[model samples]
Target: MAVEELVGPAPKGWKYKTLGEACKDGGGDIQTGPFGSQLHASDYVPVGVPSIMPQNIGDNRIIEDGIARITPEDARRLSRYLVRRGDIVYSRRGNVERRALVGHHEDGWLCGTGCIRVRLGENGADPRYASYYLGHPVVREWIVRHAHGATMPNLNTSILAACPFLEPPLAEQRAIAHILGTLDDKIELNRKQNETLEAMARALFKAWFVDFEPVRAKMEGRWRRGENLPGLPAHLYDLFPDRLVESELGEIPEGWEVISVDTEFDITMGQSPPGSTYNDIGEGLPFYQGRADFEFRFPKRRVFCTAPTRLAKIGDTLVSVRAPVGDINMALEDCAIGRGVAAVRHKTGSRSYTYHFMSSISDVFARFDAEGTVFGSIGKKDFHSISHIKPPRDLVLTYEKLAANLDDEVEKNEQESRTLAALRDNLLPKLISGELRVKDAEAFLKERGL
Candidate 1:
């Protein structure tokens, strides 16, 4: 049935309307953010009112990391662009389909350059429901289709004003949003937890390997035999040598040898199969090209290749080797990789160590990107020839044993998040379109304790 159709013997009071009509009825308006002339790059300050840029837009939420800020005076000057609670922000250019819903936390933030804001009146469709409706694949495709610009699509007030909107009774709108939101809340919680877990693991890897903290502690007499010191455990006292040795890279722990990357880990440079063999329908193996496919710790399933070339094994560290270097993600399953990525795995089969080690030397990999005149790239020769300080086998294994436990928890959380996200995605369109009754969806979620 059409989403706007009424169900049962009585009309559900749902109406089909343009986004602008709904906003006008609700006492809100659609507008573009401040233009470049109104706000220049130099106006940005270290600490002030945050200006929501395109990069801050995440999947239905505002991402604060690396967000730009303007002085309070500047924000006041561009007050018209200031977003309030319930407003939806869309990128003006590039990925115009993705957007973020303004929340209480983001109220009063300037809808900065390269963005369009949609504010609905409280009396209109629920803002939360509107956000989901716009996210519907059909709606997103429409936006992309109508967006201006050939190379990069751009969204403007006119384009967004004509967006198709479905308005149900306010109460029903909230109910549908609540059902889908419950699943999203769980998925968001998992994402945050995984971030914390990964941060802890990375910190340990940096301290133990990069800084050689244990050896330094022993040298300073702070670490006694059979006694623990912070992260250093008493049981592992014999693992570290109490001295530093000069190395080609810098000072490293004694007894550790400086060796090329190829010596300790097998490096497999990815080779792309023919473009005709690639498909998004998952006909064969999951395929990853480079950083575009990478997420927090693993590559998201996007494309698939019917004719596989170079492949990454499950748990191998995937590193981007072209354009921009050093971005890392682990393969969650056996997958085909393209030329832009390289798969690395420790010869001794320590996934945790290999993952963290690659993460630690991001600076080294970054140099390859920066040095290039055009697009940066690290070829097979340079990739394998990269130098690294290799610690004793037993020490790496011990660190891996402790680190793997933490990583395992992260993996579990990520898996749960993916499942919750899938559930939310499945329920979203049905609930929004009234194909599944809100009450039925609510009861289904309650049964799962979502």
Candidate 2:
């Protein structure tokens, strides 16, 4: 069959082939790694080679941040299971079977018990092309259909080996991989740029507020009355030379006082209405739970309810009180929060300031977190009792103004990220399934000037 027949109508004639036929030997075989029981926790070392796990499998990529390390001796024992650069890693058992095709940087990574690594053979089949196919919605659906177990879904080696795929000629495979990789590269670049911008803002916040560098300079009497600070504008000069004083919390800069968070803001907890009262079919409000509801930009899953209470307004801050303390997120839409979330409404200036202020003090909240046998939670009373240093009204207003501008920029970046993510998700399935031909994609890209 022609390439057009395989990927649908084409402008030029090209060869077509099934994935199983293109590969010298179908897909790569799966090999399960050793169980966790084989190695002692004490065997784990710091800063050694990374030990990969199912949790390390992120969307379309492998995440190495939370990876643990094993000693040289342990590595030798697991040498046979070591992952190569082009291997595809799959979480064999989990609520969501995450899959990531290993990249060049992951050459020496080792796998954990929960993950099954697949090593492709030297046939003309490209691992990157196969990874795109495996990550497709059709493949994921097949995996879910064949997965076993009632408590936790799992895929055995036999099931994984039999997963079907549609593959074009080697040349077409390379072309498709290159096209998709280019888009991914751009997405990654945007992510890193946004991260750098966030880091710059965080540094500025630390310098002005946490480190007290600006306050200290002013306190030392080095700043001239009419001159502006190095990074700050001349308008900020009038607010300098803060009055230092002692308070119940301790010594603080002048014009700053210790105040209970509750007194300065209204705190409300979310409630999960009775299950009988739930109606998935009815016209209902968007219900958000704890940290799970929070994503890089907005909430993920929204529960429906005909009757909703405790609505969080746009720009309000949602703080997790249980499971994960100190996690903060901003509300982008009017939604109802679940029990484990605490919604904060600022009594004074811009709510954006309160979000930044809470984010800055996350470490403080971590220190006061109470551990439970099953879960960890922060007591609201204890949280309120913790004294917070509140700057003078005028300074707070100035900080709020600066914070609002920064928040606006952040919101714009988030909106862009959302748009890009949606485009990628929509195109991924069509591209992988060959429902949309590669030439069509190229034409589409040219039309968009991409």
Candidate 3:
């Protein structure tokens, strides 16, 4: 029950401390971002400094996909708001639970509007340890509770400074950080690799089907019309006839069919469960309605349903069928569906093709939504009739042969990310509270080569 009995006299140098005490009189200080009016939305530019916003802080890391940028001049104009390496940025408003540590690559990135930054001292807490400590469940609970604002939850520098931290000796702090950072690094690696793999598959799809690169190659004599290209084998190249053929969907490969989705997918528009049946207790089945419930390539299981009207199986493509329609996610598990969503499975049993097919026609679906609806949405009737290109069966098989392994790896990485994340989450409070010693944590991490 006591520190000594729990983990051997707290491993000699553990202390109960508040962030304010640890950070005060040292370089580890904290502050909120620029005032909203100081950094207007009009100042955003296509390219310049990477400005970290609340949305950029994803799953404990700074994800760059959709980050806004500001001009170098503008960054200098707000130079005092600059975020440096080894700093932790917290969302100042909205989803205050989310935060990200600035790394070397993010050094000098603008802390940006709508966030708070904590600068670690050169001689105080290890930055990674501090960031991880703040993210631990107990600390996060305090953060959420102390957070101010009714509709839009707000976090500020004062709230962050008032939070408690369980401190170990500096060396032990770094060791604990090492253990957690290893897991985080691997998770980040997997996320980037998945993005790369998805891009590769999409490029292949565009070349063969959308752009008809093979057909264009043959027409230009870059590739023999009926023969093979270097990487392509057999009569596969013959599938792309040397000339374009006119179709309702415009120029497509000679033998490919432009087919309606009704013939393409075993489609089911979702039916929402009764409001009384919905809960956050993991009641019966995972539920999703729109993009808000989506994670990268998969749906986030937040709420659950007891009464189900429509459903999806693992790997079925889950699509947003409401306003801002066509954003896609694959079912990570069987889930109860809601009215704003739809699920589809490929009749041919090609999971990779099924998702890619929908993604390739996303613009078409969006356009159709614009034309037929009062709002931007695709009704079940319209979704059922959406037209898509049916690439040659053999070509689809060929693409599958090349890309199925990529999808399988992404799924495996996702599963590992979940497991590693769980491990890290479980260990954080234990290690800090001295219930689990750094040596034991090291053993656990080492066992996994972390």
Best by lDDT: 1
Candidate 1 Cα outliers beyond 4 Å, as residue runs: 1-11, 45-47
Candidate 3: residue pairs that collide:
4-9, 28-121
lDDT of 1 at 406: 86
Candidate 1 C-alpha lDDT tens digits along 1-450: 232222112236777778898999999999999999999999999999999999889889999988999999998899988999999999999999999999999999999999999999777789988998888877888899999898999889998988878888888989888877777878878888888988888898888889888899999999999899997779888988999988898999988999999999999999999999999987989999999898767789999999998999998999999978988998999999999999999998889899999988888898999998888899999999989999999988987898889888988988998899888888887877778888898788879887
User: For model 3, how does the per-residue alpha-carbon lDDT over 1-450 read when each residue is reduced to its tens digit?
Assistant: 111122123445676556766776356688888887898999999989989998899866798888999999999999988988888889988889878988999999999888898886777788888888878776777788899998978888888887766678788889888888888888888888999888888778778878988778888988874566765565676666778888998887777788888886898899987899999988899989787899988787799999888999988888888777888888889998898889988777677877887898888777856765466777777787877778767777778777788888888988888888888888877876677878888888778777
Clashing pairs in 1: 26-121
Worst 10 residues of 1 by lDDT: 1-10
lDDT of 2 by residue, 1-450 (tens): 322232233324333443334443644456776677876678788977788788788876887766888877788888987888777788878844567887778777787777887766676477887777676665677678889889888866666665655666667777777777767777677666656655665676667666666677777876666777787776777675555567786667776668888777777777776665455563566677688677654565456666666677788888888877878888877777777787886677467667777788887777646555567677678667667877656766777777677667767777766776676667667876666778988887778666
Better of 1 and 3 by lDDT: 1
Ranking by lDDT: 1, 3, 2
Question: Where in model 2 is the C-alpha error above 4 Å?
Answer: 1-28, 71-77, 122-124, 220-224, 227-230, 242-251, 276-283, 367-370
Alpha-carbon TM-score of each model against the true structure: 0.94, 0.84, 0.91
Ranking according to TM-score, highest score first: 1, 3, 2
Report the lDDT of model 2 for residue 121.
63
Backbone clashes for every candidate come to 1, 3, 2
